[model samples]
Target: MIKKVLSFAVIGVSTVTLAIGLSPNTASAALGDQPEVFHSSYNPGKSTVTISTSNTEKKPVKASGYLSKYFKGYAHKAKNGKWQFHLDGYGDAEGLYNNVRNDQTVRVYLSEGKEQGAFDVKVKTIVKKNKVKKKKAIKISKAINGKNVKIKNNKRKSDVITIKKVSKNDKITIYNAKGKRLVQKTAKGNTIKIYVRQLGKKAGAVNVSTQKKGYKESGKIKVKYGRE
Candidate 1:
């Protein structure tokens, strides 16, 4: 009798199912609102960790997070959904940056109510001692009327070319058109004389370069005079 009893009832079963906490599997997560972290970075110099995240819904919410084992803190969220965690030394913030190292990666955990996330962020490399300012390219100048200046007439029969941006200990080397080493000597000053006649007026090029005490030699530049 019970198996055959298919009687019509009120259409409140959906409400009854909801009363029994039987939410649909396709139901939206966090009431269709999810949080997302789009960008993050840690600045070792300023002791600041910043993030760009989103709260899927329109309501603003506070977020709490921690940076590995360093410290627990709350991030300040801007109206535009940007988050910044400043750990400048102040009471519990002291030593927050002391243990952080350049290029070292650390774990980050964040939460905003039902939405939470975690990821690793690397600190930017900023070693003051390891940074080497790249020097400008060395341009071979020439003595123009006793004043060292860039060689204007590259086709002249000048026996000497000025070399600037080099040390006295640097070595200057001269080469013939056929890559033959003509002469090399310690740089004396801004101007040094070379045997331009070494080319013998055969359209040969006179190349010049300099090498620091222990570094590689600079590129050889052509400065040979035209045929006589």
Candidate 2:
């Protein structure tokens, strides 16, 4: 009986060892030492960040951390048998780090699906400021003769007429087909917006004109009723 019990115990130990060797989870545990590698870049003009990974794993990767708040990032497989991650709206990071004017150092953490550990990457990038050009003043006589006014007409209510490239103190006049002045306004800035409600259902051809300090009395610009 003692010999039979010792033989049963040895058989059980061997069976458990064989099961462990055949388990997929146990096999994957042996690869825990290997981690994925990544490269990252930032473009200020395009407001994008791109990451390329060395691994071709089918699982998706995610990015997070200080810079991640300003960007939306996703991973996909590249043509070169590697993984590529794109981060959009990277220029919004300037709002996250208000004190960073020219260049910044940001941290990003990347992880695979359901993975508890993440790979950390530090990136240094330059932030460029966008320049806005001012609009030049429009030649009053040329605009009026060429009918360069932008009109937004409302059938049942007041119509809005906008004259761009105007200077302060420029006078805008609206006249009916019979040469009766309907409304006259003086421009307050580089552009003048006039809401015309005096037409009062008259749907004939109207005209617009402008007068400036150094410019001649502009030629009439014919305007159509209820049209921009």
Candidate 3:
């Protein structure tokens, strides 16, 4: 049986660091830090959005203007480079981005101080999760520690283990406690199921992770399970 040692949700950040311009110099050059969009989270109750960013040097960065359609604000920074917006479609926050719904695509551009050029666009789908109050101990496994390729929740009401969906065609590999391969396959629908009988009896614990192209492979996350 696989037992969960803790109860929590996986909070993660996705980063995009590409810049575009009409001319050569502007495309690659900037006086400012040219911050990278770290992650974004939404609040349904308050209708607020917080965009977090960090610069190349991690010193600090500033936004001179809002050139995008969904958000608008001036000199937007308090500390640690967090810009705030409300989704009312008036004043600071524009509502047409109301189209940026769960599983819906949202496009954001990063421009630098005082010079606005045609931006190379990168479209990202921001998926939001709603919190559910539970009284019993959670059933799923979490990241063994703060590491990449988290074991996302797919076992809430299941007896077996599951990995959260990954991008199509990516590989999902599972291993035994002592480091032996039990199952390996490509994600056709972007998700995989963990079966106890397939892994056999000696898999006291298992490690789960997916293959990220071009990035180093990670399979260090531990999922504690035992034989009956």
Candidate 4:
């Protein structure tokens, strides 16, 4: 019997090597094993590349056909200064992983307002000519009684703050007694000139800003005397 056919071919090769060493896929990786295929490349501004693995079961990684979700078409320089973005073509690369994988990191998103910096692509510079200089028109006056206060510029011109109240309607305002309202004019017709600088503030503790511009009608007067 040829030793029973060599003992049944050595027990069928040791039961197929003990069923491939107790197979689970050859078991060994565990702690968050993630990997099926992962690749990357970015220059839209400079750096970011990822791929994970710890082998705890759960795999799905296929994005290595050439990895081009666009950026080979080139045109980067964005971060809210002027604007320019063009990654022309390329697809597939956006998220989804199961069983809490171990090392999977490849995320780059910047092109809508632009912001995600470590580097991927950002080259900027273009402003040929823009000097900027035009704001000269300032003339201030105060002569209710006169004490020499009439700063003039004519180029920075825009003034009006007249308050002549003898019967009623003298409620004016441009306060700063913590009432804070740099400028607010509303004395439309009873001689409430208000246009001081732009809308109100010929003095500091101005009163009656209640015509509804900041509400400071608490009472204050001395609109500054002695000045022509």
Residue-wise lDDT of candidate 3 within 91-170, one digit each (tens)? 23333332222222333432433323233222222223447878875333222232333332223332366666465565
Q: Scored by CA lDDT, what does every candidate get?
A: 0.45, 0.52, 0.41, 0.33
- Specify the highest-TM-score model's number: 2
TM-score of structure candidate 1: 0.29
**Model 2 CA deviation exceeding 4 Å by range:** 1-147, 198-203, 214-216
lDDT of 1 at 136: 77
TM-score of each: 0.29, 0.33, 0.27, 0.17
lDDT (tens digit, per residue) of candidate 2 on 156-199: 78887777877889888888788888899999998888887845
Q: Which residue pairs in model 2 clash with each other?
A: none
Off by over 4 Å in 3: 1-160, 194-203
lDDT of 4 by residue, 1-228 (tens): 111111223644552222223334334232123424322333333432222221111321222323333322222224766423222223432242221112323344422122322223222222234558878654322223212122221225555455553113333455444555646544455344555453223333333333323332443333332222
Please identify which of the two predictions, 3 or 4, would achieve the higher lDDT against the true structure. 3
User: If both were scored by lDDT, which would come out higher, candidate 2 or candidate 4?
Assistant: 2
Whichever of 1 and 4 has more TM-score, that candidate is: 1
What's the lDDT of the predicted structure labeled candidate 4? 0.33
Model 4 weakest 10-residue run by lDDT: 48-57
The TM-score that candidate 4 achieves is 0.17
